[model samples]
Target: MPAPTHLLIPYSFRRKGILLGALLGILLTACQPRHEQAAEAATPPVGHYEGSLNAAGQPEVRATLDIRHPSPGHYEAEFTAPGTLSFVADTIVFSNNQLRLIRPARPGQTLALTLEGDFWRGALTLDSTRATTILVKRGVPTPSTYRAEEVPQATGSAWLFTPADTGTPGAALALLPDAETAPTAAIWADALAREGLIVLLLPPTDSATAAAETPRLLAAVRLLRGTAGADTANVGVWATGARAAAVAQLLTTAEAPRVAFLMAHNMAVGPASNAVLRELRRRKLAVLGLYGGTTASQRATALRNALGGRRGGTVLTFRTAGPDLLRPDGGAFGPGLPGAVVEWLQGK
Candidate 1:
């Protein structure tokens, strides 16, 4: 078989053409902007950040930023400057390597940060004042302030949070939610304990009826009353979700303990019924209702209106916190929430 000479180009020429093509491709890639090929704004910088906030006339303030994407299509960010500034951003957005954290409660207040290498550089603007800031990713684990021990009940186990401090607790509160199972339960319990209050964290129940929960509630109250350092006379209940309704129902029954107060956290609706409201009013129990997140104001307003003219019925938004009452990282309580509860209970 004879090969056709016209179809066979010179080997040297073919090699040169291949080399030239690869060189052109390399040049094109190298000339393109680096950002155009990078990942989308580095996945929104989700984690903890700590650094400094600088004001023109004041000393630098240490600050921290916690950013989290708890679920799909939702974001949480909390910024704290110790004694200076603290807020949970009502909305968050990241685009083109820029981050914007905003809270609608404070008009003209916004945190604008730009991603730089391994840190965020920007300014926090409040009204007309803008403070320059820088934040670097850091490990800041949520602190635990109390020791927990499991108390076995006939139905389930509960957790008792005794403050590490030697000082006697001023009051006792039975957290009647899924405190034993919820992810942030320890943080809530410890936060209360940090304020010199003994927290009895009740376990989740399987029964749907308040009748079944009544005995458990009474037992928790009794345990708190018997705790060595707790002020038995000042025992109260802190509740959320359906358990809140159960607590309300229990309060109206003859078997109910004489609870001093009821601290309701982030409830979307008002009391379970008019009967519950009447029971609360008749008992003259101090009600400290804290609402947070997007619907906080509306819920607070509704609760306030529901208790119109009733003394000891205090319902308000909880310092612009998120619904869960925990920071984005689930490490600590939201800004001033535990402190607010302590302050109100102290006054009571």
Candidate 2:
């Protein structure tokens, strides 16, 4: 049995074929680096993530994140925090095992995170504050049961609480929350809603920002007026602490909308507050001033005197519910405050 003709192929030809195949393999590998291929394979799957924000000296704030990858290297995110605050991040970057999500705006915020296996750890920077946060893949996100519905506004979002008895014309109350009083505002909204008032809870803004957002506040008033059965002629604003001053300024402005009454709690007597008192006096707007007994007695007295027995203005004093009522943690007077507010609104 001598070798077949095909088996008689030259050794050089066989060697050439093997060499060509090896060269092709090398060229294919050179086109895509091994590490890059591994990185592409190691990308974390996009889905829902649940996390908590931990800041020293601050209570833990939990968050839910919905992440989506619509195309290669592009991502979108929606983040919800306490008090049902939600914002969407259209700009997200993921590269080199790091992810960055930003809500780009003046006083913009950012979250820079790194992937470690299945976990993502990061820090959220907002304004001048930074807090540590971590997210892990979640099979399902916890449902939010916040009672108030978030209504977007030009300045920010407002929490709206409409009374069940919306068929009858009733007063529309704009409750402005102080920096630490969002929860209190919710409580107020619920209590006021039960009393047949349509409440629009304004999110807290810093004093400086509040001073500049008069037009936004006016817009919110317009939004509230547009609601069915809302008494546009009897629109009232209730604000406590620093925001009261801002509200006063807003009401006093030439472009300010018509506000029939104002309820201010624990408002300090200063340039802004003084201006507010003067404006209320000039307009003869119904005013209810709630003050803590010890700390604000003088200022409250000054406010009352400024009104000088204006027909619709009244000042109420609380021995225990002074400035602390403006604090988020101070809720001792919550149960009692709402009753007083209801009575005042009814009296109006």
TM-score for every candidate vs. truth?
0.55, 0.53
Full-model lDDT, candidate 2: 0.59
Give the Cα lDDT of each candidate.
0.62, 0.59
Give the poorly placed runs of model 1, Cα more than 4 Å off. 1-145, 154-156, 165-169, 178-181, 268-272, 309-312, 329-332
Clashes of each: 0, 1
Model 2: colliding residue pairs: 292-322
Question: In candidate 2, where is summed lDDT lowest over 10 consecutive residues?
Answer: 11-20
Alpha carbon lDDT at 319, candidate 1: 43
* Residue 168 displacement (Å), model 2: 1.7
Point to the candidate with the largest lDDT.
Answer: 1
Q: Which digits, one per residue and each the tens of the lDDT, describe model 1 over residues 275-341?
A: 6766687778788877766677887776666555435388767444566665543234667766777
Q: Write the per-residue lDDT of candidate 2 for residues 228-297, one digit (tens) a residue.
A: 5589898888887777776777777786778888888777766546666777787878889887656667
Winner by TM-score: 1
